[model samples]
Target chain A: MAGINEAKYMLGESVRMLKSGKVSNLISVIIMGFSLLVLVIYILVTLNVSIIIEKGMEEMCVYVYLEDGVNNSITEDIREKLLEIESVRRVVFVSKDKALEKFREQLGKNSDILEELGANPLPDAFRIQMKPESNASVAMEKIAQAATGWKGVDDVRYGKKWVEKGEKLVKGFYMTGLALGLIVFLSVIFVISNTVRLSILSRRESVEIMKLVGATNMYIQVPFIIEGAIQGIVSSLLAMALLWGVCSFAGRYLPGLGFFRFEGVIGFIILCAFLGSIGSFVAIRKFLKR
Target chain B: MLVYEIMPGEKRIIAGVYHLSKVLGRHFALQDINFQLANGEFVFLVGPSGAGKSTLLRMMYMDDIPDSGQVIMGAHVSTMMKRRNIPRLRRRIGIVFQDFRLIEDRNVFENVALAMKVAGIGITEIKHEMTNILTRVGLYHKRYEFPGALSGGEQQRVAIARAVANKPAVLLADEPTGNLDPMVTRGILELLFKINSGGTAVLMATHDVELVKSFGQRIIYLQDGKIVKDKEMLFRGNLRESISNSRVDHRAKKFTEHSIGEDYDGKRGR
Candidate 1:
């Protein structure tokens, strides 16, 4: 019962303190919101770029071309060998005629050029699709290398140069993203902690009075921590709102850009609230020790 | 450790300092300071500027620990008490400052009630207790006024009310009337006396020797980090005889006509 009463009093004190520093609190929230918005924007950009890269990877397939005049039995044997590979999910045989037809379709308005030179010059091929989990460039390279040495196979290609280069670029992006995310996370903590310190310094008199009157450190700090959490919630919500606005505006030029999921948004807000409490805890502990 | 084992009986000494020494920087801020305060006894800690009066009171409240020796307040010992227990000791003692350190943002009632609130008293009990305390300080009507709205004396009264809100055993005042006019000073002193009469010991520190001299309370004179004289202890070893509740006004009347410092020193020299 006493604990309940103390909690009620702490909450009342937090509300009272928040009300007293209305202008300063609003300014702090806005500044924190803008800072948090920078982080959200960075995250969204990274998320969308990764998604696009993943979609590109999903569409990629390794193609094994048979030698000219290869019989159906030879092609069937090659296809069976390709299907035996653990990474290969499905393999479809494209006949010479079907390959030529695909070439004409790809030419669209320029199909006349393709028809004039065609004596069904295209070779039969096996299009190998890997499982999503096994679609990494390294796995594709291994499959392509093994198939190139097979009998009756002219060449096995998975666009190795493009795939390897793209993989490198994606790796570099993730490395930079991780480093930048850490810096942004640390800066947010620093900003929030310093803001709380300033707020506490402004109310130093009240803290001193509370100490002199025999108030425990816990009693004094609970209210400030609550205020910090409220600040965190308000600032993060503002950040999310601003991010939505930015995403909407940017969507005109970059359609199909992914935003945060509902769970992810809720998680971000909760993480921010935790950060706020941690900032307050650090700041108040330092002040009280002095 | 063994000394802390001895507990005070009813009406016995409630606070004391024994061979207390504190060094600030290279110089000794307080050296070999010793005094004892009986229950319901009012004492003036008289000294000039830089005489370590504030330092001594701070140690009594366990705000600063002694470099050597110890301070005993109720059940807490400065050297032995844990840092976490300081607030508990503070709740048992009231402290008033010269600058009237009231929270400027809070009104008088809220300022006083904060003490109770921190102590985890229910709102109903706080309201009940606040009425009696504010009425005692003669600020019941002005409870809603902030500290800035109150005069120096009124602010000090509010501080005192807040300090004693927990009904502390002793009130430590470090030049509480330093900024007040003489007329206002007397009023503040009378209010302190009234609280003292109701069984709260007050140890008031001041540089104004003349003002506290005629009060006829036990006076501890400090100079350059040492106790030059402890009046009652020096001449009258029995503290009860010199500072009985009934003899306060009688002693005040007797000391009003003479300079007690000169008279006492002369007798000591002889």
Candidate 2:
């Protein structure tokens, strides 16, 4: 019962402080909201970029262009051999006529130029798709090596250079983002904690009087901690709301990113509450040294 | 009802200091001072401005811990005390400052009630106790007024009222009348005396030499972080000489009487 009463008084006191310091609290919320908004955008954009780049890498293929002297039996033998490789998911055999037909369909009205040549010069090719389990660069290398000296193969080609460079760029971006995220996380905590420290310092008289009167450390700390949590909660909601507004506005011009995921929204609120508790702890850490 | 009660035949020491020393940033604030205050005793801790009177009183209430000694109050002694036990120890003791230390935002009643509120006393109990203490301090009518609305004397009365609201076993006041004028000081002193009469051992540190000289109470004089005097006084003020001598100023006699007692009564000290 005594604990309940103390909690009630501390909460009331915290709310009173918040209400009295409106301008300062509002400014802090705005700054935190803006910072979090930037973080949200960075996270979502990186997530989408990573997904797109990874899908493109997964679809990478190695093409084995055939030598002109290759017969049907040789081409068939090469296709069967390519499929025997452990990393190969499937081997697609395209005859010269089939390749010409695909080119004609893609060129549309330019098919007349292709027909002017009378006979097709395009080579039969074997397209190799690697298992999803294999890394694009590794699978491409293995398949290129196995097919390079094959009886029907003239030239071995794959998009390994472009895909490898894309993978490196993505890995670098993720590493930099992780490092920057840590700095931003700590920076936000420091900024909020210092703000709370100044607020507590301004009320030094109250703290001294409370201590002199025999109020427990818990009694003194409860109000400040609750105040910090509330600030965190408020800023979180405000930042999310602002992000939602921006996302909705942008969604009209672009598609699919119009709303934040439910998990992201909930995670952000929890983060705010956690940060608030931490900020409060940092602010009042000095006074409770005894 | 939760007041720290002195059992009928318990030991009499309410607070004690033994070889207590305090150092602050390279300077010794108090050095090897020892004193014991018994139940219902009122002692005037007198010294010059830098004489460690405030430091001694602060140690009495555990606001300032000693550097190299023990401050024994009940079973909670310095250095042996746990962090969680400090507040419990404080609840049994009360302290008043030179500045009233009233919460400027809270009203007179709320300021006094805060003592009980912080203790987690029930609302009905707090209301009854606040009403009684405020009435005794003669500030019941100004209950709704903030500390800013009151004069220095009234503010000190609120400080006293708050300090004693919980019926603590000991009250350590550090110059409760330091900011008030002479007339206001008399009233505040009278009020303190009234509270002292109720069995709350009062230890007040003051630099008012005339007030100390005029009154006859236990005096613990301090100087240079040491106790120059710790003996009690049976009585002081020459009431008989003022009544017989024609050269004695009438205003001085009246001031003397008001400063001490109206009937010039004697208070024995041990």
Quick one: best DockQ, which candidate?
Answer: 1
Model 1 misplaced stretches (Cα beyond 4 Å): A67-74, A95-98, A132-138, A149-152, B1-11, B233-270
Put down candidate 1 lDDT per residue, B128-219, tens digits, no spaces: 99999999999999999999989999999999999889877689999999999999999999999888766677899999999998977789
TM-score of each: 0.89, 0.83
Q: What TM-score quantifies how close candidate 1 is to the native fold?
A: 0.89
Cα lDDT over the full model 1: 0.83
Candidate with maximal TM-score: 1
Q: What are the chain A TM-scores for all the models, listed individually?
A: 0.90, 0.79
Pairs clashing in candidate 1? Answer: none
Tell me the docking grade of candidate 2. Answer: acceptable
